[model samples]
Target: MRLEELISQFQKKDKKAFGKLYEMYAVNICGVINTIVRNEARAEEICHDVFIKVWDNADRYDPSKGRFFTWILNIARNAAIDELRSKSHKREKLNLSTDFFVGILERPEEDDKRDFDSTRLKKMLGKLKKKCIELIEMLYFRGYTQQDASEVLQIPVGTVKTRNRNCISQLRKNMSAS
Candidate 1:
């Protein structure tokens, strides 16, 4: 069946449609979560939670606003970001002090080699303008709000917003080129 029909059925609470959607997007969604969280198991858990959230809010999804995958991706991204911001997640990282210290001592020069995507992301950021790179780092990587970024960058919030949109667009272009 077509995606539209499948999504329609999903929104109507069809279990089979839900299972099909899960099978189709689980890996991609989990990968995106892992990109942000850097924890495969946690990413997988969050991916499952995101699907459940999607199922619960199925009726809210409007195709006219965006594609289904884009909607689901945004949800997954936000969920991963939330997980990063949670206190438990922070504590878990704090609990990794031994591993962190060991890693630093053992591979000080290969910090960028911790993950292939980290290196690739660094390369992608290198392709962007200095300002865009800074904005992307602050807004996305550091989880700064627009107002927070504006305050830190000493710019108006509106400018921060516009720059963020432009930077993401540029990044998308660079990613496609690569």
Candidate 2:
């Protein structure tokens, strides 16, 4: 069956269609989630949740706005990003306490290297314009959505998107030249 027909049936809550769609897209979707969340097991779990979300909200999709896969991809991306921003994930990542004999479980040299990398990152951002720094801090460091950044920056969403792309490009150039 063609993708459109499958999607239509999915929107109508057809189980077979949903199953076929999952078979078709699950691997790719899980891979993307893993890339963002960096945990294979968690990515699979989040992928399952994203599919459930997709199934539940199937009727909300508008083909005229974008492709069905893109809609699902956006949902997966947002879910992965949300997982990254979650407090539980933060706590999981913050398990850097000293071991009984190891002093810091993470080596002191690695810690110093991380501090140096942070200082270098700060220097790079300092070289960028104030607007670029603010945009990077919001979209990357603080995990603001593009729409949220747009509202906060008082710019259109498209403008925020454009600025983010341009700013990242400039940042890449700065890093490469150094």
Error of 1 at 99 (Å): 19
Name the TM-score of candidate 2: 0.52
The TM-scores, one per candidate, come to: 0.60, 0.52
lDDT of 2 by residue, 64-109 (tens): 9998877888898788878776746575653211121122222454
Which pairs of residues collide in model 2?
none
Which regions in candidate 1 have their CA more than 4 angstroms from the true location? 1-6, 14-28, 64-70, 81-86, 89-114, 117-123, 137-145
Residue 27's C-alpha lDDT in candidate 1? 83
Residue-wise C-alpha lDDT for candidate 1, range 57-119, written one tens digit per residue: 999999999999878888987898787778466655422111221222334446656654354
Worst 10 residues of 2 by lDDT: 96-105
